[model samples]
Target: MPFKRPLLSSHTTDDSESQSDSSHGGPSKRRRVSSPRNIEKDKTVLVYILQAKIDPEMMSELAMLVENYKVERGNESLEGPTSVSELNLELTGDVEKADVIVTATNMRQRLERHVEWRIAKTKAIVTPLWLQDSVKSGRPVPYGSYIAVHHLEDETSRSHDTVQDASSGSPSNMPSEAEKQSCWQTEPTELIDTTEVELLSHTAKYSCLRPSPLVCPNQSLVKEIDVIRQGRNVEGEERSMLSYSRAISVIKAYPHVITKHNIRDLHELPFLGVKILSMIEEFLKTGQITEAQRMLADPRFQSLSAFITIHGIGPHTARRLYDLGLRTLEELERYYEVKPGVSDEETMPLLDAEASANTEAAGEQSIKIGLALRHDLGQTIPRDEVEEINGTIMRELGHIQKGCKSVIAGGYRRGKPQSNDVDIVITHTDWNLGSQKVKGLCRKLVQRLHEQGLVTHVMHLSGFHEHNVLRTHHWDSLEKALTVFVSRHNSSRQNVYRRVDLIFTAPEVFWTAVVGWTGSTMFERDLRLWAKQQKGMKFDSSGISRRHDSKLYHPRTERDVFKVLGLVYIHPTLRNADA
Candidate 1:
């Protein structure tokens, strides 16, 4: 739908048996004509899917791609509304007639099927460089069940013919003699360059959602990165082939897409997608992704990845262990399992198995938080940490519940070295089971922990800002909150000093607040942009409500919350400190 042309293809048949077949003129070929006016701006519908919701880089890529397509085709084509369902209805008054669903990775299976079975009669394109593998491998497009692939083969053949005729100082099949003498011909159909933008990537790449799934949000990039990574630890000749990794893969998937690439003269390679080409006649000046894939083969990162997989480790911990000359699970085992009689550390300090076991427990949970954040907050946290930085009264003072509904978030989630404190969110199943006794369970947990001394201190619950935030709160009574204090004792001679926050959440606001409180400040700000600026919805630390009507929208799960925001769901572990 980001295309400037209406008809997908136009072809000419050889005249050998045309008259005998009774076909209509054997389908005369034609070319697209340019218009000097803005075309896409006048469309009634637009469906814009975001691959990296909070990525400055990827969003910039998408905008450029859209604008460029307009300039090249000399037409303004509308995709559809931002919402997918609305685009499907074919409502007469709907301003969106086009469906431009975007994603950070490959098109998801469900959304693809939805478009395939139900929304078949529409236009859609899923961007993001990560989609190269899926699109090339014949996986369904995330936009819908079937793709309206713009046919450039016929155009290619036409262009070839036209060039051949011109080389001889004349177009052989001109409409008339006057047209034949013309030095210039009309615009020939060609394959419009597809857009491939990445939302953002600092040291780590983030999926559109904070952390939901293990797969990359951009399917193509994921596959390509995997292809590159898997090809690592190679022999002499294989290592030499590394430099051409990205370009070779991109060209392979789309041979004619890069009709030309002068790799030798290029310095840094950049992938502009369709946007830059609109502005510059030669956006793809070189046949490279532009940045020059230098760090494509990172043996160190792969090794760190291996080290962090141990039981009690996080990224930071693993990194430190690596620095200390212990780089893998095997090395750690070697150190701890030295011969029984060896005085290597007596000579070496004793390596107690139990101490390591406790660390392993922490590391195992850290992995969970990481996986949970894959789509919820796409970057991985340290080996034993979650990703966010919030510590409410309940989580900081929470009891080790058998089933108290617990999730660790914040710096602790990201596996930081000595966090100031831990943030935990809790709610009893019967928090609102139609009786005060049932609801009292939440408050009771705080009391039980306080009595047990796991909590060292407690902060009085603060009232809501008593000021405007998203214009949704009533009377400013602190958004219906609750908290409690507790203290913990240490076996050492020194007193312990750390605070924990345990928040009792109502069913209606549980998921939203759980995720909100579990986020990094930056990532949460991005969520705000999606809510207030993009989706016309309102999200607060307390709950998610409708923008126009101030209707409180209670999501049954975190996935639903992401769905309404027009984003892919991320998991916990991947949320990282950025979330």
Candidate 2:
């Protein structure tokens, strides 16, 4: 049984005296200081200040009051007065020694990494209010109401308690043997046909071979799993994130709604591991995953997700920013604020030398631009706007070089209602122009667009030579410009800033470029995987190349590329694998 704090005596007259003083129009009398008899003299308390919002001075004052009260007790031991020095007013990096930890932030957010181990050690983790109440009541307060419960801690404790109860021959919450066996033995009366299940099991292995629609019957379930996946991504769990992605792809391609009736069949699908299947089972039973819910509500996850949405920031950088305590875009902007006469060390004291150097090399300018246009860039681009933006680029390209054809790809090509950005693959049929000339196309077109007030900012430009023109062998190594485009809406009279990618490839590989740029990420990924594994060939935005001999095959059309790879041509509209 858990230890319970003793209740304060009801004979105490402090409350009545304070009320009498107030009613008589006199100054409220201060309550007399009393030593807390219930507190263990040697127990160590650590006050950890996590967030910037918490006042250190208040913690110090509270610690001083507690310490002074302990000293007033004059409790003597063999060495003399009992050590009032056991209490830590500041974070001392010795978490193991703390009997009680009072923190400002949520316990799950702060100590989630090792919460189970910490709980197993029997540490009483609570909020600052616990300490305040303990001091006010002249005794340590009951930890039941003040305990900061981490979700994982609760699960760990329940499992531990169940095991202990079973060993001790006490009534336990653990499922009975008969109940456990029934879960797997019980089958639904209406089941999917065995032949259909076999066919689905075979086809579901490769996402590229299947038609994944933008809208799926299991979208709600997929969304919850995806949130957990996103949380893993933010935490830099590469393998776990990929596993979740694979599971989500399989679920999205599933044509029917996921209910308990067909959940047993889901185990047949590729990438649906025991863990993922368990999550699906839990979701089917409760309509939500506990882990996903906790992650969705975590401030740290929210901040990291927001940071990675910026153009230049990746998971690693976003994690670093979170470590620096930057929670919002506004806070990030302030962190990068350049003040005159202040050194970098003074401006960003939290950043170490190595991090500072990495920041300078990591396109800080592009990140700042992303921050400035965060709202505009975050807005989804409708199909109409996507076409309009494509048209604007095409017009500008025609002026620079006639017969320059452009293909609008990305989510728009896959038939999504809205896209996050525009990807355009531009190529010319003039053989005389050569590879050298094609390399300069992106730079020239972007310059023309910038002059015309269409291209606002160039985030990145690559695959261009400065002095001597180099011959490019593959379409994947084509010249490209990542630019921000601004278009005016006539009705709203507002300038909408959009992200655009212009890929300039030679005419010979034009079809391959179109095939590469038109993608749902998993579709392209599996295409490459299948080509390498099954066909003994390498595939990319570039044309096909034989892996054995390294000879490139020029694809005349998008269908030709699929034909070369021995696959039936999947229409662009049906290429939404894990959309």
Candidate 3:
């Protein structure tokens, strides 16, 4: 029996079922939330729960679509289970606050019976997996309607640092219809009325792209960190100045930074904020922050990241796991598995198992990879060498086509000067002869580099066709000559464990392409919101388009893209993830 959740805002519903459950030892109580807006007045609620693997590589891009869509409609979209006992406690109350309910059909068997909706009309949008289940059950998903879409892949282009467009539109507040479609549009495929249950594997375009690990303990941390580094340039200034990256210098040493002083003294230190203070204090007393503690106890992280940390799981995914109620990798391993491989069903806390297994696996992978590549990609290669390799790759392609233009984006373009991977965006007048031919060009280039003994363990991707909107690809072995990954020593002298992403775009969306690829994802997200909320347009890493009419848009330059979005151009450094 589930409990009822309190959602006292726009609508109301009775939860006698939860009350009954509570009378039998539960925590079901009625309460309400005061929201500033009453979006439930006469609209529907669409709740998307990711029940499958989520490709982190595409997270920033998907966020663009979600955030932009909401702004375009001036609507409020709420998520989070808010509580367990969800059906008896929360759902009944939450649904009453809306005129309609829309959920991904994936949980048809798992959640449908647990949380029953009695509304006259309920809508279910089936993904490929959900569709298969529906067909197997001989069900029509008797709801408002079912729409199956490849949400992540349809138009996942990179975002520019600022304004994200500037490919075909002028610096104005409004983007023409043409500009809108260039960014996003529906590409309907054959009806997914399949009756098969065969498992299909999917991959994100940039599944190999990963988050940077935390600051190294062996290395000194940055000091002279500028506080409030970025702000809108007053009329006297341009767009908000970007955040400071490289610290001027560590002029002072603060000892035992964590325990040297209390929150008060820490506040007096450079760059410490209330939030950061809380995190530090929590860690000092209990050896962890609330989030970290919660994360450690969750099953997913314990099983996944904790163990996967050996493979470089970052803070972003750790938090996402915590949010999913998985406190440890152990829990993740033991809990809700779509595939039944691990068998330890004694029903202990779900997250603990995940954490243990995750830790063990991470340790093993680290030992294996570190030993293999210790002599190779050990210390950072000279920035010059990193650039030289990329330059060589691009120049080789250019030799294949005289006027082809190739740009290295991602952290390299962001001025990291040092990076774990290299991403190249190409465009040319003869698109087919130049950019469109990158897949073959990359193979020849990498093979040639290998023959010269200047290239080591390598992976290359072309035509990254994304399948499922949720979990996509594990790019480790999905490339040309992936066997190089087996190297015991990842040497960067010539080419040690290097990840490269190559993408080709039409000349029409060339600028958009550049903007999308040249991004601090955070800055890109902000610019996208600016366009949708202020300019009545949808902005993505791929293209800019009209919101009302759902049209494609293009801007020729980065400045024009921002101008059209009613914003000044933002620099890459200013794009902080926390922002």
Candidate 4:
């Protein structure tokens, strides 16, 4: 026979009419009225429980406790009944409209999949213990102690063991037990194998030797390291920044999902130091890096990062501005203006008058223009806008000279949805033209664009004269102009300034220039590194040269360049080495 549960009821109140009838001493009548306990039930704290991995008996008890629970308000009002708080706890179904979510420790990742979990920043996600304790104590407890961590079976350990067993036949294929032990000094549960996993087919050291896609499986970990890398760059720690960048590139190129079980694969890669490895382990354990979080929350670092984004502002200038007590772009703008009776010593105590004067004279106009149009220039250029801009440039180029070809490089060619700037490489099929002809074509294109109200400002123009060409040694010495551009047909009805770089290359190195300009920085860096170290060739945007004899090799196509370097041609979309 099944047992029947008893129903709980609140105290009833007597109606005023019933009291008046009893006072009249006639045949008295009684009526029931709603009580404060029933009124308190109207206002409830909604809690949704994720039942995975929780004991059935415990869950049953929790449901009963929640149904009978009342949050004690403590005797603040000594003269009246204490305020009552009721619980509207649910053990099953969706978490919509829930103020709190209680789940098992191992179910954090599952809880994160809920849309409400991410959108509601104030919603509390706690362990079952929090709810149990809250009911026992008659109030919601502090969430700090109950934030969940995974306590399920360690899949990483099982996967690592499987790979180790599979590679046992070839001892040299696996890292020695001592090396694996040394990689992590914590308890056995925290140990991470520092050798390459057999499951991963590729373990190349150079980024050019592997494929790195834009969507990385380890993006969360990559983001934390990038934050720290940016902080180092802003602080002018070049060595540290390069270290983080190398680690980032390696991580991005890694094809497998990064987990504690397979983290040892990163150890096989070059450029990742013990510090970076420790941070990776920390993130896998806690979903955050302490150093990265601290830097993100630092006010001074925030100010410096903002300043570095301004045109013509580098790390040193950003630091100097910070030293002068300037914490924002507006403050820096005010400082740049000429003020009467404001001596250099009074305004910039950190620098001498001569140094201040030299800094002011250098790039003053560029800085002023950058500040004036910061908002317009800072907006990202969508793919459609980039295409429209490219069309405009092509039209102007056709008017200036016939039979010219062009390609939009940079992130656009790499298939990015949006880009910070537009880089266009133009060249003619005719190879008989002299270098002066190419320079003249570039000059005419800029002039035409300016006359058409497209080129609003010219930040730089190079390689147009013989002296400028002789002064530079690289292929980047191609005729080029960096200008601020605005389309005459802006559908947004606003003057949106865009940074446009126009590079005019000779027909011989046009493909090479395209490859150079369309790059993820690490991919290009590794390509050059591979050429110099392995092929004994110097590679750049201009062309590749045999370092042994200074003989130049002109690759007519992008594939020819890769073939000469002995690298598998990677599509631009797969060249995202997140440096």
Candidate 5:
């Protein structure tokens, strides 16, 4: 037999028919009063129950109460088994057919994964405590309304009242005839609705032109896109990865919700091509993108992704490993003949034994350093630890040189919860003292840090190289040092080695260096591209300059550099282009 949810009401009605004969004696008049039974009988609502946190015993009791509740009036009894047929109570998993769903807060996310809000017509009502209390009493008891529904209605009413007062006049306090006349006589003011369009139409063309943070409206969709991009990168598909990055960049900057309607004109959006549009269209039509789903399930992609997660292996190396049938870290270790206790000097031989050996001597040396710090490179430095390290470095530098300063850059500057490494740009008051090079200042700093026992190992060091003043270039020949530092959070004797990059710059280019390194890589890339293509200028970590002019445009601050490039200054936190 079909089941019906119990109806609770504040008042009961007479079950006997209250009919009066008409004067014409043709028919009887029936007065209609709002009653719980009448309301239940009027609409046959299908209800679905979700036992999120409810126990089995309580659920069984609630089900029984729903099945056998009596609806009584003054004299005649309406409490029969047939009355349960009024409601089609469904215990099946087909939530779409339901009109009302009873669930808890914890079950909402679980349900959302299966049924999207637009397609599922069911209205979810949080299970209220009063419902249980009334069910236990087994009477026609009026319980409190669902908090979720009640709060939504309350918010809607409040918003409506506020809008009505602002746009239209209040009903209780009407203006006098004279005041109305004066209002009509006064000049009218035009109110422009600026809030409707949240995104800046002009600046939305490029992702770098706008500010994007780690959280946004399209975060979930962006995450899927990023996953596919990473898979492509693992297969050494640079072109495909670039295409996916374009799609990701545009989606990150989009301020509106991504729906089928909004993305219908995908061609009009920048960097979104046909291939990406098709994926998006598929995702909108169905809940998933076929290509991404297939890629996720592919064993080759899985192997490559896992291999790429290692400290030094990049996409190309990961692909080689995949081709060699090396799927897991254990397999990789066995293939490379990596011993349990590999020393720093032996790291190079182990790397060379891998499938894709480094060809160039310089590249091999870099890989050796990377291999040496493999464990440290993989460990994440928390935000607090980064700050603590920054403080210690600054204090040490201050002691070494009177006016030396450092600014933390890279992922930490962009407000990441954790970072792979800490980047610091160092400059001094006397850096501009009529010299092309700082004469072993990098070595001096390393020596001081080593004496203080903070420097664990000097990985690689590059001295200053002066660029030919006549040529247009992309990057600078700057003094830099990459080293591993020993860091400890508490009084633990064991030390954690973390990667630290120190880029020493002249005071003249300090601001530009800060703007360059304090980056989400994509942001820096787009900024440089924009500078060259749009302004006919060249920009790099060194400084900005006109392509035809010899003089460098030195900006004293990051905001000043943005102004020179005719861009709206973006804060560090908003520079997360992948967001």
Candidate 6:
């Protein structure tokens, strides 16, 4: 069982009495000398819990379990009270007093920055399934050597060597060959400076796995890198752009502002290659990179960036527009009327014919409505207005389905002050049957919402065609409906049209959908990149799966997904790429 500690304050009544005794006892016996046995009896281990990334509920449960139980050694039954020296567990908030520091495996990556520093100060150990395993088996089983809390103070004090050398059927006794090469010893705890080191280590090599708020030290540096990355993207240099973005992410997660000294020390940092490092060095030295400045002045890049802002426009289409000398949204609108035909090898070659057919079939009124809706989607909504719309959605959804759930995703989920539009993912508790019924379920919900006058216009509706909801591969791909909503502002006495997307997911991929949709685009991009490039896994809105075997990985929660992918579970609020 887990050991319990007294809830008394750190300073006790006996300590004050000892001082008073010393003051009255004169010089001869004033110095109270403790024998080796007495000193040994008085020795106690101090521990500090790193609760930064730990779940509150789990932490509380662990603390309660520890408070209620006592540790027992081999062959000893947990029948009676154990001696104080046998296993005395005291949790301290003071890092200086802690002899051991406890943390979770999932938080290891985030804690990497502090590993060397913590190891110098205290014994840092990883205990996998800490609460569950300990509560189940009634004993602590350390997962790793460096961070293990296997033996209590009694057994540990008896003979340190025995406890250290004993085999406990772990993966291995000694460090693996791979780990051995990377291992380094620390200086004595007395010599270590806690003030100089960062406390919380990032849980993953990638910044996306850790929460990075807008107020990070390297925010300006990241912005500079992003401008260059955006230029790379505009020029169709995806590989180079990704490399730059990765470096930006690493810098953004860094705890302190970068200087020449610290920047040079970042050779070991993720994605900080020679080229990217040199670019950063150049920027730091001159306050800007010539290449980035040059790209900013380039007409092609300027045009492409603007063109891509149009609804339904992609890099390919933007590039095509740029080649045709379209430099602004106004220019694109003019060109659309002139040709109405734009195509590449992948796109429809009979684009003009298709446009004509679509117009003849749906009429000019439908085309005009589509254009107006697209224009509305491009407008940004204030945070207050966004909240009002969300409130209206909740009230409307509650009437549609009693137990319906809605998660506001996109930029809003990342804690953006404002959003271009609202993207909501809707799911019902009762609709957990499978993907087969998802299309119809979403159609029913959307139709009801439309009938209620909440959804003013349908821009794009997937899974349903020609008023028929079909169960096909296309419909099952993803059930989504994009519509314009009528948001009324009582203070302004106006009804504003705001674009809102309703994405539906089955019970199986509900969590996956929530995570995927709730993204700062770069966060999702880097997450997929890390999973594929680093872990040899595939991740998407659909689900996680092995690269080769195609076996699906079903995670019960969002944190479980991060664990499976070997990432730190970053909170939604800190996933903002803009910040």
Give lDDT: candidate 3, residue 37.
22
lDDT of 2 by residue, 198-271 (tens): 33322457777776778889888889999999999999999999889888888878888888898888877889
Residue 341 displacement (Å), model 6:
23
lDDT of 5: 0.59
* Worst 10-residue lDDT window, candidate 4: 184-193
Which order, best to worst by lDDT? 4, 2, 5, 6, 3, 1
lDDT of each: 0.37, 0.64, 0.37, 0.64, 0.59, 0.55
Stretch of 10 with least lDDT, candidate 3: 200-209
Q: Scored by Cα lDDT, where does model 2 land?
A: 0.64
Model 4 agreement with the true structure over 310-374: per-residue lDDT tens digits: 77788998998899899988887688773321212221211122222444543564566566667
- Runs off by more than 4 Å, candidate 3: 1-303, 306-382, 429-495
Regions of model 6 farther than 4 Å from truth: 1-204, 337-376, 431-439, 464-477, 490-493, 530-536, 547-549, 577-579
Question: Candidate 3 — number of clashing residue pairs?
Answer: 86
Identify the runs in model 5 with alpha carbons over 4 angstroms from their true place: 1-203, 265-267, 285-287, 334-343, 346-362, 365-375, 434-439, 472-477, 490-493
Tens digits of per-residue lDDT for model 6 on 1-579? 223433224454235335534754622221122422212222233445566455666566556554455333212433333522222344555555554455653233445554444452334343324333433443233323233322222222232232222312222233322222112111011211222123224435655665566557777667777878988887788999877876776776676777887776688777788888888898789888778788789888888887666545657767877888778766765665422222111112112122234423332232334334445555688777777776777677666555555667787766678788888776544433444445455556656666786765554555522211332332233567666677775457455667778787664556677788887777888788888998898777666777766566655445556767876556676676443
- lDDT by residue for model 5 (474-509), tens: 246456777777887645746777888888887667
Using TM-score as the yardstick, the better of models 1 and 5 is 5
Error of 6 at 272 (Å): 2.1
